[model samples]
Target: MNKQPQGNIFHTPEMFRVFDQTKGHKSTLWAVVDNDNCPLALLLPVHVTLMNGLLRQLTTRAIAYGSILSVPGTAGQTALALLLQTYKREAKGTALFTELRNLSDLGQPQTLLNDNGFAYEGHLNYLINLNRPAEELLQSIGQRTRKKIRKGLRDGFVQMSEATTLAELEHWYEILQKTYSNAQVPLADRSLFMAAFNELYPKGMAKFLLAQVNGVTAACSIELPYKNVIYGWYGGSDRAYSDYLPNEMLIWHILEWGANNGYGIYDFGGAGKPDEEYGVRDFKAKFGGDLVNFGRNVYVHNPSLLKLSKRGYEVYRRFFIR
Candidate 1:
């Protein structure tokens, strides 16, 4: 259980480490407001991944995964001031700012961060409320796309729960690896996915869904069901199944499964880059889901430092990511 201290908001390294694993960042720095005893507020740098040629980072309520919890009195601004007190103290340092992506207000750290010297970098987010009826939703889809989904249903693809055991996570892992291989992108640690899955499965917090053809796993998805909403967090499909419309069909099945199972909303997770809606935006719009402007945050030491940091990030990504 999470232990809360008296009045001080103490930050725990365990929480920050979890964020690091989920975000897949190379370097991270952490801070918390505490009276030297209990842990209250949580703060850490996410996406400290090499970007433009600088040490870039974003600090938020829970900078790990998508949604993280914070202490009752902790706020973004509160976390920022404490964070800045350390980084800013490093004399001759350039301004350091972070762009928090795909975050909506449920424990927002922005209001407080801005108070301490953070600034609104820009809007970065998307939300698919699982509160609408399937009929209302299907009616909104483009006629052509709707036909594809119907065709998928007519096909033999079926959804099955794949969270019966740790072995079940293996199937999901294979799908994730295939996705990365197809895109030539770096794959995150499978063990991390397992830890998350094992921890949340029983609580019904998340589940792994599979679509098979001839009993062979062709497509799979990892979804998180929390509160009244179900998030289509992660999933991948075989391109060969594209002809069968596996992606659309799998999603349709997920929606149907959620509705019948008592879930109200099905979040399609974030689309593309959090700030802009170009490609992924159009994709989600095809589902007839409404666009939601999500809140984001940026914390920096100052202007000069921020500029220098950007330059550093450019060089870093070029050497590391590219």
Candidate 2:
């Protein structure tokens, strides 16, 4: 999979290991291989369940983080179709839906996916080029963002560092929990981060970072760095420190760090659907990256249950997430 140019970190063995070890996450690998056993197409879809018992059934959904990885041309398309058919047959009663979160243009496979019952939706993402001088990169940021970053650094109260210990990871997760809770969005189990720290961190595939204000951690971001790109995974900030702009400072620090460290691009993991009013997308836009509509495709295995699952999720957020 790594040999495929479009293959992403989420499709790699490291991520598969992390997901397999994480609570509420079950990853499955599917591939189409030739007679000689050479792989033609591959996919790693992680089945995510958010709650316990019955609620778990409602929340269960499979996400293919980087979509399908296939060798170039018609042969790859044929393999993908066969794999999709096999997965669909076996995936019944397992989840409400299966979504492919695409990272690149799937020219021919897009039609293949549609024919196979995967409906496409427009999604957006930001990709910032980092193959330039730090000064150039700084100047590329929005005027206001640049000013805030400069002022935040000038204050001398904000500091950034890579998280190393379990205590530090816990602290970072606390900030993320508060942020997600307040937003009423269900976050992945903490075990996911713990697993990433164990499997991906040691190999330099994952980076956990902390931003501090007056020695107290105020913001945190977890990134997956693979090949020449750094994929922003999860992040949050303590609103109490909003005045310090710790989030902005922390992001700029990563951009600058990436520029100097030889990385080629910084991927804002995802913006939201193009038609939606997502504040996160607006915030990422100010970072001066090229917006790309990689979009996503989803196949609903249980349409009736999907509707119920949506309502159930709201209830779950109210009673369980906090």
- How many steric overlaps are in each model, in order? 23, 0
The prediction achieving the highest lDDT against the true structure is 2
lDDT tens readout by residue for model 2, 1-322: 6578898898888899899998889999999998999888887889998776867778899999989888888889889999999999998998899999999888888999999999999999999999999989999999999988888878888999988999988988999998999888888889999999999999999889899999998999998889999999999999999989888988998899899999999999999999989999999999999999989999999999999989977777788776
Candidate 1 at 307: error in angstroms? 8.4
Clashing pairs in 2: none
RMSD of 1: 6.4
Q: Write the per-residue lDDT of candidate 1 for residues 1-322, one digit (tens) a residue.
A: 2243211111234433433456444325444546764433444444433233433332112133342234655353455456555543552122244444434454445555556554544443344444557766566666877888776666656445565777878877888788766755555667557655655666666678887766766788887766556776677878776666656666777776776667766777765545465665676667766566554555554566556655764664455442
lDDT of 2 at 114: 95
On the 0 to 100 scale, the lDDT of residue 15 in model 1 is 30
